[model samples]
Target: MSQDRDEASAGPQPAEPERGGGAATSSGPTDDDGALAPGAIPEDEVAPRSKSRWAFARELTVIVVIALVLSFLVKTFLAQPFFIPSASMESTLDIGDRIIVSKFTPQHSPLHRGDIVVFEDPKTWGSVPQHRSLLKRVVNDSLVFVGILPGGGDHVVKRIIGMPGDHVVCSLACSTKAGPLTVNGVPITEPYIDKGSVPSTTPFNITVPADKVWVMGDNRNDSADSRFHDGTSHGKLGSVPMSDITGQVVAIAWPISRIHAMKDYSNVFAKVPKP
Candidate 1:
């Protein structure tokens, strides 16, 4: 009876369920190390993680492209930056100063006397083009085109003193000690002229043609402006064509200590009748 009980107890033991079906039973899925197997890690999980990284990079690239496009548009139409290259504007705008110009004038806004403006060099204006190496020129042109750099040495800046059909005259005897400049036969006070400078030393009398404007610099004596080009071979080049005007200088943007809104001296020309 004792021997029979031992035999029954040791029988079979269910063969331990053949231990995971057999070594050749497809062995299940395994990790990189062939240790963990799948389920501890999902089959679809790693692919999504890789896709998420790719998605983030794509999104970032799209945002950057949009930002660049907006910047280009703003610079081309609304406003632009320009740097002062000479002392032509003196106290109002100095050499090396950077300024922001608004495109609204003569478009969305009316230009007025005493309004500072930037315009294309009217050829006879005697502006000297800056010389630079080919590589440097390319680099600068690119930056300016993208609105990342201020334009300089190519355009001119001055204040508008006469509009279409206004009779502008400066007497030959006019000196720093002499009193005023006449516009439309009315003597006008110019508070913006350089302290020791006169309205004009070289006299001129002309009716500004239609669609043209007479411009001058604040540093009158030092500036080769309308007065110098009044009767040049270029024929009435003194008066810049309205189309040549780029924009109205709205503010000084550089040299933090010099940052300020540009002032329009409307009251100075208020008493003068329109011509």
Candidate 2:
């Protein structure tokens, strides 16, 4: 009975766990507070992505601006699009034909007698009515300045017949005769003229003045060219100042069926000695 009482007093001793709970908790994912631990990221790895995007945008803007400037300069000083507004050029250049004119040609070389050229209309040529709205006008003028569109109003295209200081004469007889249209007493065969059209129905003889050129159209019968404007209000009707010449027609650029380079008329004037 004494031994039983002593064993009862030492009863209810603590027991050892079957699994290692402390080690399991220490090896788990989170800290003791149940919060996630943050990973270390290097300062170099967190680069400025927004800055890179902004830089790209700035570079694109610069490229677009440069492209626009280059286009404008080319149109203003090198070449431009010119639309044929009349049938004066006929088979060579019909109405609606878009041609490229090289402003550089007139600057580098003197205007030759057989070259086709575009020129600003003389004061006596009068003005065409403006049928466009303000918005349309602004848009068209802007596009034309950049060589994206053709010019409108007060511009004409013609072939040079007499250069500075050359004597030019015409006759209705030119349709049948080879020498009716003469420059400095030398005849020019114009095969480009519309068939059956006379060179000039109204005869006139004049010496082209210094710094001026006499011009005419290929479709002589239907054209109101230097011959038609003779003795007009400007007095210098048959001649346009070299300063008024814009550029030489180099090629037809639009309308897929009519795309071709401008004809070289060097052979046409080859026999004529320089004055």
In model 1, the runs with Cα more than 4 Å from the true position are 1-28, 31-39, 42-60, 232-235
Once superposed on the true structure, which residue ranges of model 2 sit more than 4 Å away at CA?
Answer: 1-60, 129-131, 175-179, 232-235, 273-275
Clashes of 2: 0
Residue pairs in clash, model 2: none
**208 Cα displacement, candidate 1 (Å):** 1.0
> Per-residue lDDT of 75-175 in model 2, one digit per residue for the tens?
88988888998888887889999999899868877778789999988765554566989998889888887766787466889998888878787754664
Assess the local accuracy of residue 31 in candidate 2 as a C-alpha lDDT between 0 and 100: 59
lDDT of 1 by residue, 131-239 (tens): 8999999999988887788987678999998988888877865644475778888888888888788888677777888898999998988997887777643227789
Question: In terms of TM-score, how similar is model 1 to the real structure?
Answer: 0.79
| Candidate achieving the largest lDDT | 1
Where is the poorest 10-residue window by lDDT in model 2? Answer: 20-29
Taking all chains together, each candidate's TM-score versus the true structure is 0.79, 0.75
Q: Model 1 Cα displacement at 167 (Å)?
A: 0.9
**What is candidate 2's CA lDDT for residue 273?**
62
